[model samples]
Target chain A: MGITSRTENQGRTIFINVTERFDFNQHAVFRKLLNDAKDGCEFVVDLTAAEYMDSSALGLLLLLRKKAGNNRVELRYVKPSAIEKVVSASNFSRLFDCKAVSPL
Target chain B: MSDQCNTDGSLNLVFKPVSRRLALVVDDEPINCVIMQSILEKMGFETAIAHDGYEAIEAFELLAPDFVFMDVIMPHMDGREAARCIKSMTSGRFTPIVFLTALDDPEEVHACIEAGGDDYLSKPVDPRLLRTRIYSLERIRSLYQKLSRQHDELLFKIAEEQENEALANRVFLHAVSAHNEPISGLDSYSRPASCFSGDLVLSCRLGQGGIRVMLGDFTGHGLAAAIGALPTSELFHAMTRQGRSIPELLTELNHKLCRILPDDRFMAAVLIDIDPVKGEFCYWSGGMPPFVYKSKDQLIYHSSSGLPLGILENYDFVSEVGSGRLTDIERILLMSDGLLDVRNQEGATFSSCGFKDLMDSWASNDGFFSALDERLDQHCQNRLPDDDVTLVSIDLEKALAVLNVSSDQSADLSPEPEGWEWALASGGGYLLDHSEVITALTDTKYLQDWPAEQAERLQTLFGELYNNAIEHGLFGLDSSLKSTPDGFHLYYEKRQALFDDPPPGQIRIQMTFLPRQQGGCLRLVVQDPGKGYDLTRLSELEQHDDPSRFWGRGMQLVRSLADNLIIHPPGNRVEAELRW
Candidate 1:
């Protein structure tokens, strides 16, 4: 539905929380958050509340990687759900650190 | 008071007439009509006068005045009624109406507005107020005219763009499907979310009595995603016609797409090659949904195990191909992910379980695709899918039957009375650089109108014979080096080294076509100058039973396809005869 972000550890790390659907509709906010982040800062994208994701959302994540550099971005709380197949099918695990965790 | 300045020393209003404008004045009293006419004439308007509401309508229709002034009290028809009639007749043109009222009653003014009065003059009719009101109304009217014109232009442009898009879609569809061979037992359905579909389905009859099919889904739908289909189909049909293997075709396709598409865009594809004669199935799946194979008692799934095409350069696609025997499998089904992602009115998807359930419910494979399509329609309630959807069903039994009939018919061509002969000789250095010489040599003008199957068989026969003469005779390389799978690559590496610095030798190929009573005969002779092998070695290769061995299969294949074969002196020369 929307995107929210907060900085912690003196701005060295940023946690981006995506709520509800993660799709092309969230492109603007996601791009702004990525643009505003400081250089060399690590990013942790939280997908715990996302119920669905589409191909364009995957494209956005690729764009984020292109801007943040390799290994500087990590995806946390990717539930072992239907959307996981889409992510794994594209071999996204080879490009990013994807941690699949159980839903609370 | 002075005309240029009032008592307060403010500048007086100067009226400048851009063009001559007409004004209509209506009143029951003569004094009132004269007063209005004097004010309008001073403002540079040519005036027309009407005595009552009846005359006012008549004068309006005749003059088509730019502006009108109507008294509140009149005979025959009241000014309010006349104002309504005049406004209706204007027909989208802006004509400002000013009502002249003697009484200062707000009720009368409200009634005047209800009858389409633009503005009103109170009592004696102030000239200054009328001048300012007229100026503002003219500005508003011009603005409305500009907006209406723009609205019409926008509508026209949209229609033109749609027409162009439809024409382009027709051309694109033709390019994608024109080369498709209508082979039986192959059924497919594709629907796009927009004017253009990114899903591509291509099937071509293989030159060697089989069929090759590829179903690919690009990154997204519509025109941007469909652009890659043009080159993909062209390459596919050309390569399939040349009798290339599945792995080789996939590798070349991957290289072509990677060079053209963007970084994030790629195609998820499944390629299947069926050889009914050998009862073999070879498939390669990359980043697509699992394909299903339904047998007599069991259903098998083959999931993708490699990245999609165009994602990485230098992809080793040969290792990704999986091969199996067509033992009990009756039919195979392939689909894009869009089929599983289709959502119903309740926002629930038709997942893999639904697909499997439908397959189980079917009693036989005869109506499986129709049943699947019906189920999909029932689940989604005729809703257009969010992405492009493609489904392909291939019946193995039907395909085998068709293959058998076609192979038998290839030999049924009527006898021809024409005869021709051709010969070519090339040095080792020239042959190494132009390894495709066999294709050129087989594709002569004399064979242009022959059946494709016959022409392709001749090409295969020529390829094997030429390779044997050059590699075994001229280069003196041992066929035993290709006994193991890894040794196959090593053998090629040594052959490539020899090609770099080839020995001094020449290969001469001569072909003669002779007329016959039933069909024609092609006699091909290939000669080379090198140390010939033992005559006993040829007999051992003819009876080699291990079909898996890659080294001696070339001579065995030649023997099977040729009607007559003979090795000339020293085994450095071979002749093959084929009847069609």
Candidate 2:
């Protein structure tokens, strides 16, 4: 599994999705997605399908926050419990708005 | 060739001659050799003739010809055999061989090719087909030469780059680990995913009879991640040598990294300082996994509550230090997150629960590190880890022994300089912000030859005296405010507020070193401008039996560390004499 992204709301918002493993392998693709997004657009990272994440992934999120501005970036549906532990451990909540939807 | 006319000129044609190429003709029949030689000479190549296989090899070696025409049938040796011999003599250089065959059989043509004949012609070879074959083979030979030359250049470049990387790695390793002290109780293992490790572990002997260890993991693995470690290690060793506390060291490290590193990069680290004399352990963790302290009966984990270094600026950075009694801990284990993130073949991680289970299964502290190493290897099935892995374990009793022996080493008894005096006056703002002044005061060129322990003690003595004058005399902050935990926080807060816009006052410091019969003595004097307090209160507080009270401990420490102590009238001046 890998990273994918799409635009919505007439290109006003971009939704980037990460699946399975999220680590350094995704660095170039992630930065390219951030770079391609329209300026001043809201960014939402969907990690619902992610099973593992590393510190490099944390660094990528920090980079995204820096580009998207603090209020415009949000982490949606951080799930599988394990990834959420990393999110909290790294104190990402202080830097971005994170929303986790419980799996049924 | 082209003809051109100049201004006064007649028509002129120019010809540039090409270098002649040599060809060899091998055949037992004189008629076949003559026919091949005539055609090759018509194509502007000079020719050499050989009778058979043996003669062909000799002629090929002697002439170093550009190409060869071989006849299939011969007297002593066949044309195919001669072609094979000539091919062997050419080695890596390409020399085309065309066989002259009368037989129309496909098997004979295949045999000619098997003998290294590049192509073949009929008994009466046609000049036009011979020219086409020569032109195409010459094109292939030139291409091969170009490719071989480029291959050699690429190999040379790669070798040069590898040598440079090896040299840089050597210098980097020395800078990172040369200052590390070999303490008895400290054991560590580091395995980088690549040639250079992003993880760094440093251990330094604190000046005040203890040890300080730091384990830091940068953003990624390999050379890019390893770059930040140079500054971190340099700062850690330099500040620890000055006997600075963990918070002060962390503050400076954070500020330095923040100014240098990019926004996406930061270091996750855990630092532990163990004071053997006080029987205490203090640590600061930032964005790293929890460090575990294991006793015989219980285990304690200190988790990180601060952001990783280089992420927050100096004004927003807060170092949260946790402390506990050394008696309660049998061993302290610290690791990078990479250890827990190790994955098996099935993609299952060696999570924290696995670590806990392993710790629980250990019956005793003996060989714990070895056991953990074996377990990790078994879990990963000998595959190289995806991230750099580091683990450190410190045994309390052995660490204390190392510290005791180090402090007990007798100072060098060499004669000292006759005498020297240094003095400085600084405003309250400068004193509050720069603690390096304490180090500078004690680290004069004259004292450079003193034993490390003596120099460290003088630094501590000066530091305590300097903090007293600024915190109590200049700022007028009450020591009673530091008795309770909340008040301790408040006291620092008030101190920081006062430091933002320091009050108008100055403190004077003077130090004098004098050589004595046995060793030497240092006289330190610090004067402030505040009104004096009751001198009797100091002795009363010293007699009090409350060990946990934070107030009055600085004065007690000063008194114990100095051989003679005096407070001048008005309580604004303090004098201490330390003898070696």
Candidate 3:
């Protein structure tokens, strides 16, 4: 997967777009992007263009959520498809503000 | 090179030759040949003499002697060449050749050995040396022969064992790999990692016009693990066609597997029963991978809440049942753990998130299975996976068309029965497992004379109607409680607590089997005392776009089964008519 980022809302909200399959292969790029994330900054992961994700990717999200734990930076998910079933089943929705996917 | 012998200038050696030793002597000189033959005979061996190198090979082939005494300097081919030929022809046979040498030079002695002789016997042949060489070589030949015979026996045994294994494989395949009736909507692809697979999908038509599909994966994939599939599928098809409930089926499966499977083995499975006319599905899952039910719009899922089948005793196992109403273009997908465990070159398993995301992509497309298969194919590439990967999809809308609900009539469309009237009233002031009450109706004498198919359909209708009366009419329990995980448990517990008294409304149920002039009719009425239900709610649910809601599932099911569903004022008193 390819990761691209943009800052909006006066640099407080950073939206990261993950394209194609999101898996362990994208760990390097995801880690590089995470380094720029600072406290009090809101991060929105846009998976609208993503097609697939695995538990390893969930593990990566877990890693970021833990890292953002001290920052109080709000981690929001945008346009997640029904793919959020795994996340919901695992109770990750309690940690992140998951936007309901558009009905098919 | 001869260190074991005495190293004196004059050879001093003691030798003892065993009787029955056979020897061949090759010499160019006739007199030498005679003398060699006489010495061999004196040593108790049967002698065969060859005059020259050419004669030696010919005589050796005829004699097959155990030992050879060769003159080093001989005619046509010479002793060295003849010894080389004989050694090469003997293959594994240990025929020791000792060269007869008159020369004292060490180089001449070395040449004889390099040409293939085992040792040098100096000539003007010393009888003592001849005896020493012959006796030692004879002992080795005896041991080699015994070893060769034992090797042959082992080869025969291995062949027999392999034959038995092949026969078993054939028998196992014949037993489990037959599907006579193909269900149109149910499609599956199972690629075994080896000669046999631990994954299986079995389908059967239920007596009540429902279709039962069971997808199972055993503990491991291969020949040994595949043995479990035989018993599991046999029980699934046999019991499902007999109109057994999901829980009852699960109990039998668990009982069989518990006795057969090893402690380390268990089957993770999902069993679904779908009624085509009513478009309602009830499922029970145990330890299988998380599966999803997808419609045109939203996705539905229930937690996998029970232990895998075959791991527990029949009485100890508790399987939670989940119900859903199917919408147009509705489908359910069940996958074995092997599908999720598929790893790429980097050794990362296709995680739960990946499966969900992939399913999401298929939401807008009808080729849900194709996309999944292609993506998995690409992910695996040319390398075969180490586990059996299986994916099964049930096409509900398509199955509805294939599963004809109207086919329950007698094949002859026989004249309708003009039987005697009868009635049975159950659940007067006590709460019961209402489904069990209908199940018991199958054994009634009235239905016993009816065609088995008609009797089963009538029983199914009773089950759906009885359940509705108990939950909504008698107890006034809201259907929405079924949305949560423990909602059914709570609803049943509440029903249990109310044993001391009846529901708020007056409760009455009457089942009448009446004979009409032209046909037969079964009239069933269940009236519960309570404020009447809102008719608007039933109408709204009837036309709602999303069928996944918990409300009005049983009513719609009843409306589909009965010829007439009439609700009186307050919607508390309901009447249903079934005409045959």
Candidate 4:
């Protein structure tokens, strides 16, 4: 009922869609999805369906950055449908370039 | 002792006076002497007859007769002369000498009277008159004996009481003499009404950094009031030297006093802890007069906050702490109620309000205590005080450096505990009571040797870490959720709900401390039975941890304080190590 993801271009680019709550409970599922992403691939973490996201969800995003690896991987972000204070406070817009268009 | 007297002040006659009531009769006239003997013998008196005045004096000394009848007109030495000599020989006794007068002449009777005769009995004595006179005089003699006996007993009782008071004074002097070990910045004075004082002034250097000064006044006065100080002083000295917190000291002292003292007795006290360097001051006052911190010329008053010790069963005592620049403080004054209640020759008291005037006039000077002493003495002079009084002043100088002297505070420091753990059910609502947690930690043998400050820091650390594991792991209350206005409330409500009926999970903690040659280190591992967090994220936050960055506040706190912090894979279990 929360998050779903799909791969494209032989997993070179990944779109991770999150729905409902993206709190700590989704950490394991999110981890598996990010670990399988190819190194230096483009990954777009979509939180458009997420109604709520806690600090652990932020932790997951940081992990996603590592699994994606290297600057060439290009960690992109899709803003949640209901903008969370956690996102604004995390400076994720600037840190992961979530607010601008994906460079890749 | 009979007080009944006949007309003309003579008493009624009695039957055979005891052998100890022997009467001596002296007369040169043989018939007169025989008549006197017959009368005295009939009245049950043993009679000693002397023919002349010289013989009368001789018999008076030898027999020490209770009654004497002297013949007024006698040869050799006259009756009057012998009576005078005999009276002096009797020392301080009521041995009465009655004159036997045959001649009906006023001059002769008068002469007999001047020579120490108590009354006159005419020669050829009237039987009734003689009987009345002897009975009345005998009544006076016995009453005098009884009064002398009582005087002797009274003297003895006084000596015994004085000796007991002196003993109580000796013990009291020794007990309160603990104050004699002068505190560097503190000047104090105490005086008792009687030989014993009921006040205790205690000040000591806390091993860490601070001076704890206490002035306690026991209820009432003298021995009963001073008795409580013996135990109070022992505990105060021991605890203050070890540098225990004021709350612990108060709670333990209050508990012991309540246990040992009768319901009617209690101690009114003021306890102050001053960290001169840090400019921190904490105080707990009960029943004593309000305290005033004199800074510059201003007087800031703080009223007492609790009942006197030993009165409450389970006192919820709290100490008030304040911080200000130490250089601003002039002096700190503490006093027992006795100090204020002391009165002058005119019966006017110095009053608690007088301290303000004292501060205004002289607190900044070196002669502050002397000025105060002069004021108290001027008020009371030599007039006895009604209570025991104590006053202490602490001048704000260079941060009470006297306490910086490093004493071997933990001479018998308990070795670090080997290993122990407690597993409380999630349903235990108040299992994590901070005091209980602190007690549990301090109860360890190794923790006992740890300095109080260090022990306190660890208690705070454990509290934070354990709480995080239970809340974030077991309860799964999201930290980021708190960003919302209602999130904190909602999180607490959910937490309380879990306390009543918690999910199937357990929080287990194991601790292992190792003694290093340098010092020691403690390793604490806490685990919760819940889906663990991703460790890669924990390291991510740790790498670029910004304190202002909100979410992982708890983890940030735990990681920063601990020397080595490791969150195992499946992040439900975390280990932290602290080195000392």
Candidate 5:
């Protein structure tokens, strides 16, 4: 599923909740979700429940970083699946956010 | 009892009928029955005689007589009882039975039907109608047998096809089972399609220098995909053992596949070479995912695949396989598209952002594979994967180093004109004493090879070339430039001033070497970039009239010095032969 919402309580804290599964069929839906959520909100995506993610999923997150004005989303991945790990390894993590904790 | 034969009393034991038919005559009074039998036999049926109904029943059971005329008034057993027994024997099947009645009573005819009779006639029965009915019943029986046989064969064929399909599925499962395991690579974990995986991962050492690693994903799964694996595996194993370069192996694979693979089939692949000693890695990508390398500080580099092979004929991948040197403790990760394109239960990707954070946090504490497994497991929540997945990783520090010494040295030297090999033989421990020889040597035709403005660039080049000839070629010196410092500078300065002017110098040069079609040679020849010492002296030097003259010494040193050398037609010019 895809992560959708983010809100900043203060300059120090941010929260991001899941929105939808970022898959081939839902690519368009996921894109709209990201666009709507990225209106100057600082958040970290909580992925404790998402079971699978693909390259396109990674692409959308990259788009989120760009949309967050100065790429300051400060998004952190809480948990990632086996497939997510592979997508994460592809320089995306190096580009913006860092993996936080693997809840599994 | 009467034995009669027609009207002529010739033993008269048999009755003959005018028509070609047979009739059975059964009677206690043989004489009366015989006459009746003859009368019936005259009509059309063949006839036989029986004294009692018991004998008649026996004949009917054995011969299956189509038409029977029985006497209701028979000895021992009655005709009505015999008819009932015969009817019971042929129940539910067609057999026309006719009964003979002495009395024309409707009640008697009804009693005969109850005895399983089709029709009854008076004592004087009309035989024509009986013959017609028997013929019609036989025709229907033959038609029923033909239709039932055809239906049984069709059912058998459909069952056989179902069994074969099941057998094929079993074989496919076995092939994929071999690769199924708990993986522990950069991104540890595996996902296959519908339990029948088509993507393949292979690792083997290539020759003595490099380790060959590859991941291949076919277009479709099951039988459509299985066809490509046999060739893919065979070529990969063979080429890796032969130490063929990735390009060569890829080209070979493409050729073989194009010849046999169906039009719809194709394969996307990524090939890698990791050298532990050189700390270098080479990658030849066809159409896989973007392979990445993570630095100790978390900096990332991406190497994406080119177009897949076997998609087009004679398509060449010309660029050098991309390569990089690894830093200490760095990690290199490779993956296929399946992992990147996965969607979760809500139809959304795990996303690259979430993936990045997960990796960066765990990158330091755990191995890449374990961390990958833990992170993905957390994100997916133990859901099944929808696509095929593969991941590969190599430790940066463990990867070997590749040094381009030939290119480095060539950059320092200069190129000579076509078709020349100039060998310089320098002497003395100090280069100062050899100034005149250096100046005279530089004045030869060789200095004229390059452009005038590039003279300074030629200084270090000529210095190396001259020193190499004098120390290595002449004195058999084994000192390498990398190892020697003292001789290097002296050699540099001597070479600097030599190319300052354009002059004529009869420097004799020669060459002797083997040349190849695809081979080339580069030479750094040094000579005075100036006019010759004198035309007469040059002519005399060319003539070599005085072998002992020091003025012609440069000529002699160069002439016998190399494989082939020529002072240009202009007295001041010198040229070296480079087979390349």
Candidate 6:
């Protein structure tokens, strides 16, 4: 499962809604989302529905940060899945700001 | 005439060239020039002629001959003087010159050679010797050509080997990543050798009890070192899945390596188990470096393994290499010799002392694993390491839960719960080690409160649990054997006999923890394949609560401490549960 889309305006903030599993199988999906980032806005990655993430997926995230370049596109991880412990082990919190979003 | 093989494995040309380059025949007499020219043409070489020594020198420079045949008897200048001048001009270059002389005296012949003539040919030159000399020189040139080609090939091969080694190193890293697919709570970094460095690290679960880590460095490098890794990894993961004891696993490993390893090599390794719930650590080492346990204070405990594998044919490893107790919030440090031997820019070794101090400094401030890795990289000056380096740190704080409760909550809560997860952890006959049993208990949710006191009780419970399962369940020992002194002696002998011929039956121990409205409850059931026990006397004795009841002490002690103890069995199973 994957969420390949741009950030939509949610009231005062613009956030990207992720509604599927992120893995190595979704190479094209991740590549497109990274290429299609809009300019001049803080973006929150809403991971409220993602159930799994592999190392390749994590590696894609790092590549996305590099691709963002001077665009100053800050990625915020919101609502990480309980089953996915890779986030804590890799210590992504130190590299990126994470804020949990309540379940709908 | 045809010539055979030269000394340097080459053949001399038989069919001479028809249009061979011309040679100048220089002499004072026109008659001698004519004779030489006719001979040269017959030998398939073109000829040029000069009458006097002065004319010969002028003609020599204008038309450079491949070789020259000059006569000593000349007008303006002798053959000696002209030869000296020609030799000087062509010094270091391969230009053959033979002297043509009518005089038969030794003195004249010596003078010809001293004047830089390569060889002396009498007034009647031998055509056979001329052909042979040209063939020999050509052979020298061809030999040099072959040598130059081989030299170029050798250089190419070396470069190809280096490129292949780089690619092999990348593949080894991929293999490690595949083995350790998804890691949590830590970021692992490894750098492998291109050719083959036997040093490797694996972090995973050991029997679902706790996180298990293994750091191994084989005897040699390259393909020889990596062969053991395949089998070692297979055994490590297989035993971990079956929940086999490290001692038992080590025994299997030892036997396997002894049979497989070649005469010259062996494996040195370390195995570590860390329980997230109990925050306890257990480890076994086999001739590996001592793993350091770091505390908030400057205290460090070193855990070392016993022996390397394949040393003995039939070896029995002691389950515990060292004391296997660990505290919560502690950091365990593991490393290979690569870290200790890392040389600085000034060529000084980064000794163990330096490593300990570095770790202590970081651990004091509760440094994360990433920070520690970064500090190590900085210390090495960001240069490539000469030897392999691997380090793993497990934070005890993250592994344990520290919470306090008020009186109302404390009163309502019980140490053991009612219905939790029921698991049957059994495998190969090697789980007798106290450390293995402790780790298994600590991994379960029921034993999360594995304080020093609770551990002591668990030690007793395990001893009884194991003995009862082995003796009564597998060996079918009667409880009435303790009734008389004679019976006790006979029972001891019978136990030994049973061990000698051990039975094959599974002992299933199930434990559950349930959080009830009033308090939590605990349930334990140990089932065997044997017939059910006679519980009529035990049920009657439970009402009296006598301290000195001979037949029921084991069950009585369990009943008194536990809120509920029931014996439901035909003859083989025991089910018991305790609340608080």
lDDT of 5 by residue, B1-580 (tens): 2222234453122222221244455555677567666655544456676666787778777766545666676889877788888777875454555666779899988898888776666765444443333334334433433444454565676565445434434654454334333222223346664444557776665444345677777655555566776677778877777767778888888887776765435666788776533446778776567766666676474655465555456766557378777434356666777665555666555545256664564456366566666666665667866667667665433222111111111212333223333232222112322344435435555445544433333343334344434432333333333233555565444444443321222121222122235444433333332333344654565774655332334445555434455544333344444433
Report the Cα interface RMSD of each model, rounded to 1 decimal.
Answer: 2.1, 1.2, 9.8, 26.2, 9.7, 15.9
Residue pairs with clashing backbones, model 1:
A1-A21
Error of 4 at B211 (Å): 2.0
- Cα deviation of B334, candidate 5, in Å: 0.9
A-chain TM-score in candidate 5?
A: 0.62
Q: lDDT of model 3 at residue B139? A: 67
Tens-digit per-residue lDDT, B439-554, candidate 3: 44543455666666666667777777666676677678787787675886787788667644654333445555655664567777776656666899877877764676545677
lDDT of 4 by residue, B219-338 (tens): 655566656887888888888877788878888889988888754467778898876434468888876677777776777776665556775567666533333455566678888767
lDDT score for residue A19 of model 4: 78
Give the candidates in order of DockQ, highest first: 2, 1, 5, 3, 6, 4
lDDT of 4 at B326: 54
Model 4 — TM-score against the truth?
0.49
- Residues B52-81 of candidate 1 have per-residue lDDT tens digits of 888999999999998888897888999999
Clashing pairs in 2: B532-B570
Provide the lDDT at B97 for model 3: 90
DockQ of each: 0.38, 0.42, 0.02, 0.00, 0.03, 0.01
**Model 4, stretches more than 4 Å misplaced?**
A1-104, B1-20, B24-34, B47-150, B175-180, B220-222, B299-305, B319-327, B344-346, B350-381, B405-580
CAPRI-style docking class of model 5 based on DockQ: incorrect
- Candidate 5 lDDT tens digits, A2-82: 545535565323455554354445457546655566365544655545555444455455555545545455444545464
Chain A: TM-score in each model:
0.88, 0.89, 0.75, 0.78, 0.62, 0.66
